[model samples]
Target: MTVIVRDFRPEDADAVSRVRRAALPFEVTTPRSVLFHVESANPAGKYRLLIAEMDGEIVGTAQVGVAYESGTPGQSYANPQVHPGRRGQGAGGLLLRTAEEHLAAEGAVEVYAWVLDEPEFRAFAERRGYRPTRSAHFQRLDLAGGTLPELPARLPPGVELRTAADYTADPRPMFQADAEVTSDEPSDIGAELDDYEDWLAHTWNNPLLDLGLSTVVLVDGEVAAFTAAHTDGERRYWSGMTGTLRAHRGHGLAKLAKTDSLRRARAAGCTDAFTSNDAENGPMLAINKWFGYEVCATEVRHVRTFG
Candidate 1:
């Protein structure tokens, strides 16, 4: 009944995915994405996927990495996910300790992790010297039969809706829009998206990104708003990001992009749609609620500063 923590191997992708899906059912992930996380990691990230194996079975994992994209120094994250059925075992604690050690060695001064709002999970993190900071919610929309509002009959003059695939020739416009909107997103460790090649490789070319289902709003031929979609290629859809450029914020562009994307998803036979946002992001949360998305689960961000 001993649990051991080790580094993720090429062959352990499936096991890692299983643990993640079991622990965080609201998020969408595949083995390919799991492998991509490791292979396409930025050298500066110092990314390490730690796995906890017990008696020859992998039970948990921690995604540990330095927040290299952030302008701030010493920001890092390590999220541990253990299979729900295997939680009583010591897999989670071992994985956390291993992740912290790895992150600390990589020059991390403060490590952030998401702890489930449940008492046991919160207690687990608190006992390890982590303190609650901000919270986030995982919301789900029933793409098949839910109250996804129909696309507006008139999309406001000079505004056009297009799929991300339309930018196949050159995605710099989408990249520009994404960067500006993302720069405004709330986070303890903010990211700066300045590299075009990195965005093309890691985002536009990612296997999970559904180009056809992702809807973008263009106003006067400019990327005004967009919703990036991720799917399991069958029935599950996830809103990886939905954002509106600063200039277009008060114009209902966010809702327009999401409405069009949701209808597209339902038409594509996706049964469920998942999304998440920081608790303080009231505007996006309100739009999601308008689309009938219900908060399925909440997780609080926890951080520990190493002296």
Candidate 2:
């Protein structure tokens, strides 16, 4: 059977979510979140969701987009995921090729993708001229039964624990904090979060983001640290970001924020928690480890520059 890659349709959300869950069990995604991503993508992103179908069955999918938020232009990304059992049947190659073509047409001079840190996965990217750049680990925590660190019984003097929902009236402060935090995050590609409106549309409004579960550490009324929580509307929770502003670092604020968020998520019916961290991010990784999050999987960030 021949594998044909085509644009994603609205009805493909469920199937796409199924594939994603199967291919990356440590990640949290729902059909609603899937649709939200397509509906809310920034125009400058030039995003495309493509599917690979063979014999009327979708075997693979790709997320292609220009890094519109990048400080440097010509940076793009395409992540293709084929069902584990369906690989080697040409679905992955077809999906990647389709994504590359779309990205190149959008003026992308380089493309980045994450390949599972496995022999076959690495070979696939290398064979196609992609080289490994950095690596990240997917970590999972069993929130239903495993014990999480106890939250501080009382605030530390001027410290207060607040949920992101507490700032519903004006989220500009949250937006600004997120921008500063993202700029300091470890990554091969840097992002500039200058557009408050764009962040409001794509990040704050994302359906998967659980504002009630997101924890913010307020030091004397300023946003010192925060951790974003994403859920699948039920039992799965993911930590989107655990950021401590520059001046607030070295105070164990990141750990405090994550602890607060994780406790909130488990109490809200989330049985599992997942998060990823670049290998070089020792502080965050150590915080997650202290929470008993085990390494579930590792993916190598691979890149290819176009001449």
Write down the lDDT of every candidate, Cα atoms only.
Answer: 0.92, 0.93
RMSD of each: 0.9, 0.9
Per-residue CA lDDT of model 2 for 1-307, tens digit only, reads 9999999899999999999999999998888888889999888999999999989998889999999999888999999999888999999999999899889898999999999999999999999999999999999999999998887787788899999999889999899999999998889789999999999999999898899999999999999999999999889999998898898899988889988898888888999999999999999899899889999999999999987
Candidate 1 runs further than 4 Å off: none
What are the per-residue Cα lDDT tens digits for candidate 1 across 1-307?
A: 9999989899999989888999999999999899988989888899999999989999999999999889999999999999998998999999899988888898899999999999999999999999999999999988777777777777788999999999999999999998998899999989999999888878888889999999999999899999999998879999999999998899999898888888988888999999999999999999999899999999999999988
Angstrom error of the Cα, residue 12, model 2: value is 0.5
Give candidate 2 regions above 4 Å deviation: none
TM-score for candidate 2, residues paired by index: 0.98
* C-alpha lDDT (0 to 100) for residue 55 of candidate 2: 94
